[model samples]
Target: MKVSFLVSLFMLSSVQATLWGQDLITLDSLRLQLAKAPLAEKSSLYEQLAWEYRKSQPDSTIFYSDQSINLITREGLDRNIAKALNFKGVGFHYKGDNVKAFELFTSARDEALEHSDSLQYAHSVNNLGRIHLNQGDFFKAYGHYYKALAAFKKVGDIEGVAYAYKSLSELYQSQNNLSKALEMSQKTLKIRSKVGDIDGQISILVELATIYELMENYNRAFDYYLQAKMKAESIDDAIGIARINLGISQLYSVQGMNEEALSYADRALNTAATSGNENLTNQVRLQLAKALLSNGELTKAKNYLSKVVAKTAITRELPIEMDAYYYLSEISKQLGDLRDSYENFIMYTRLKEALVNAEAARRIERYEGRLEIEKKERENELLRANEAKNQALIERQRFQNIALIAVIVVIGVLLVSAWYIGSKRKQVNLKLQVKNRQIAAQAEEINSQNEQINVQNQSLQKRNRQLADLNNEKDTLMSIVAHDLKSPFNRVSAIAELFNITNLTEEQRTYVGLLRQICENGVGLIQDLLDVNAFEDQSRKLHKVKINLMDLFTNEVRAFYTEAQAKGLDVQIDVSELLYIHTDSSYLKRILDNLLSNAIKFSTAGKKVVLSAVEEEESILIRIKDEGPGFSDLDKTQLFKKFTTLSAQPTGGESSNGLGLAIVKKLIDIMGGEIILMSEQGKGSEFILRFPITNVAPVSAGSQ
Candidate 1:
């Protein structure tokens, strides 16, 4: 539910003044301190006030930050200037003026570096990293974060190190490396706990909970969420409380505990409203709407969803806005408001597409901005270098004029010295000419080597093109064979079927059976070949749709049930009542067909073939276990290779061209799924297919 990473810049510890019960008291204390304190001290207090007001009052933050900056400038307090600049940048950052924030942070970083203030410099660097991270410049953001971490470590700043860890955790989470994210979050949590930083610990706990939730460790996630909620309650952090409640609600909603989910959603909504945070309010409202909708409370769900939609129209929160429209559409459909449902659905689709396009544009803009910044920096460097060179040239020219004046005073002596110098210069020129000739010889040799390399490269290119052509021709031939040869085999089988086997001799019946068997085997082989070709084709794409795994598995297994029965093999299915997945139905069918066929083919008489599906936190595992002659070690090594026959033969004289598993592997890869084989020579084989649960509805029994 909490997909975005927590920006470290926003995770400021509560000031001591705020602990005294009221913002007004904190403001009075700050103003009193400013009025009585000296100019130098006033700047520090002003910065403190800026920090205090940052979350609640952006204008106040900017005003205090400016006051601090002005006083620091007048007092020539260079060391504190970067802090003020950083505070001002935070104000702009919160106000969504990222460009201005970037400029201020850059200046702050430069000023801090100039004064050798490692701690301040790291803060500015971290802030810049946050900006880049938000802009989707992961590489640049990573570089800045690493630099900040090193700087913080150099200064032995525990708080800075903790923040850097938290930022890195967020970065890893963004990359979907949940394991690394958990590691970093834990590291940060340890530091926070050691320092008794309750606010920081609360943030880290929520992060850890979210990560565990994503990993499907629901119990652990719930424990962490409860801990975070207790901590937030102890501190009377309404916003934090709201966040924890929302997380819990989402967890329960996903688990289909609608009653508990609705309870938490209501609690979160109240807390968010008390906190007076519109963003948090909207988020909780959306969660509440989902819970209400799930419970069939159409009127209440519509009320909450409509509020969020109206709020998001002004906030332009694309993700929540889209969700609101989507849920509204669902609610409308449930209430039998067909026109409204259709309209809301259209809006949802339009917004979703717009958000995707906007994200793509933002990425492009970030890259372009980075390039422009680098180009400008390079130009500035060149200008500075040219200025230095010009200054040096002027000094050199001044020295030359002085030397000329001195030489005029001793013109005759200089002429004699010049003659001696000219003789040495001529000797040097002769040696230079000899060196030039040697350089020319080396250049010629290099050019000849370059020519040979070019010739080899051209030859390799030609050979590569020929190989590509051969591969294309092979694919074309396979396609032709699959299409052209299948018809003839079908026609032969039909003609053979027309013959009356009862009137024929025993030998004729045997020949007729053999012909039909050959046709079936030939057709299967050609289809396999075509599947292999299709798998290799780059243009082939998956047409993903929401499908119930139980339905698909049952249908596929039923198709081969009769064949299995003929072989004296019992086919069994152990699957959930309803398990949904977003995948290409045809491709998934092929995968199931191959695995099921192979199981039935190799399974001996009186053996059982079991197909089972189990849902994990983040993925689903579909296992096909067969009591067959398991693969040998060598056969396992070459398994899933196209057209490579292994030691295992079909039990019922069924055809095995060794392309089934290969096609299965390819399809799994295309679907972003994984296949794992667990087998032993004497034991049965279990083929486990794992597909990540993505873009699919939650698993629910008897739900469409």
Candidate 2:
């Protein structure tokens, strides 16, 4: 519409959460309150600031969201944590880091679903729709938008419903379904006006204008653009006014009024620049360049286009970049700069293809193909149903014919009845033959599809084998690296420990202590690496024997006594005498050691860790409770993952290779035991393990 292939700016989807329904508190006031707020209230304050700063300062929004997440997670107040995550992803989305935004959005959605936070779930779902839309996956985008819209409606969130409606309108407009697009826009406008959202009303008006313009209804489009302009100017929204004017500029350019188009483009660019929103400023420049190109002002157009291209190096606007390169190539060639034109053309081609990658393109093709297949299948099903209905009708006719023959025999017309019956039988045989032919054709088609599926399955199997081989190589590499690094780390740790007895200053002693901690961390990492390889081996076997709980507890306590003492922590045992169980002693010892070390690692200097064992009805229960910073519910889900990074860090600067819990989980499974974590943030944590006293180990335990 604008003599270029650029996507409309209005088509970019907005996040579900905005300043709508927010409190009237200012950012400065929120920050001031945050400074003096107690720990319990700070998380909420941070969340408020995050929403407040979302539009004007995205980086600040991200920072505040991080602050809120940390506090809420630590305090075990998970109500607003998912919302904070959603807001953080919104920040990244605005900053044009779609990949990072997608990750955060997924996490937010998962967290919301886990906690049953319907509102946040809807927000996150709508935001995910926006990401998919921006990435040029229209089919997926539509599906996500529909899902979010339903969610919003289910939650009775009027604003969220409007957001999803507007998103759908934009998506429809992009795909050139102007009628449906207009309908969706009208729905959005009704909601906007009902809610008294003047800005939203203006946005919808411009969107309606864009759709009409694309429909070639220039007069109607112009009227809507003017209405949007009046509303934007009434509210003194500089950026909004600029966008409205830019739309008008495109309309003028379409009608070949180059002079008027250039005038409006200049005005829009000036207004956008004065608003201090450089992203909008650059976008207006792109449109301005198009107008100039249409007016045959090649040099001036090239200059404006160069500025737009420069902005793409910062935040990727694929559509804008693609269009800019396209125009640059054209302008360069017209200016007799053939080499420059060629270079720009190459870039234009690449960016165009990159807008939809090969993988996404294939997915879209498959989606369309599957839709077609489903349509045909539905048609076939209907055909079969109709044929069955016809057959039933024919069967009823056959019975009625038999009754007619009896009547004919009673009336002495046997010859006529026999002739009619023969004719009817011939017709039924013909219909049956046709039906059988159709069935044969259907079977052939199904056989072809089955062949295709078989080929696909074979391909999938090959890929899986390749992945397995890669995993094996990774394990081998990990073992080799661990074996190679263990000796060096041990030597470093030993040397650092020896320095504790030397005649050194306090500062030197502090350095030696830091060195010792580093060495210990390295050794821990190496050990964990080897453990990963061991746990992944299916042939790794477990040896079961009788294990006394008191002896095991005493030995574990003595082993970690020095480590606990160094951190100024106390370890207590609460096991009765003569406590015994039949299981792999080495497996149990490793599990106890790992849990104890973790308890000590996370406990503060004055906190105490309690380890106790008690006999239950069918099993023995073991509890390792720590009076330290406890884990959040979210953290509990990640406890047994290999090398999972969690919200809580080790207290006293102790290191965790993130493999101990994973190994412990594996060993417990092999020995026929169950482990559960009971924890609350800022309170304390307890790990409970249950094992059957008699016949504990499973039959397969000896096999691995």
Instruction: Judging by lDDT against the true structure, name the best candidate.
Output: 1
List TM-score per model, in order: 0.50, 0.42
Kindly report which residue pairs in candidate 2 clash with one another.
none
* Model 1: pairs clashing at backbone N, Cα or C within 3 Å: none
Total backbone collisions for each predicted model: 0, 0
Residue-wise lDDT of candidate 1 within 341-402, one digit each (tens)? Answer: 99999999999999878756655665676665556557757986998899999999999999
Residues 1-704 of candidate 2 have per-residue lDDT tens digits of: 31011133422433112212233458769878988999998887887787777765779889989988998888898876889899899888777566677778878987899899998898898888777666566777788899889998998999889999998887777677789989999899889989999978987898789789989999999999998889888877676778778889989989999898999899998887776566677778998899889889999999999998998767687778889999999999999999999999999999989976843564464456445434544765798799989999999999899999988787776677788889999999999999999999999999999999999999999999999999989888888888889888889889988989999999999999999889888887888778767866779677778676888899999999998999999899998766777777878888998999889988889899999998888889999999988998888888899988777788877777788899999888887899999999999899999987674433243431
TM-score of 2: 0.42
Model 2 / residue 358 / CA error / Å: 12
- Cα lDDT listed for each candidate: 0.84, 0.82
Backbone clash tally (model 1): 0
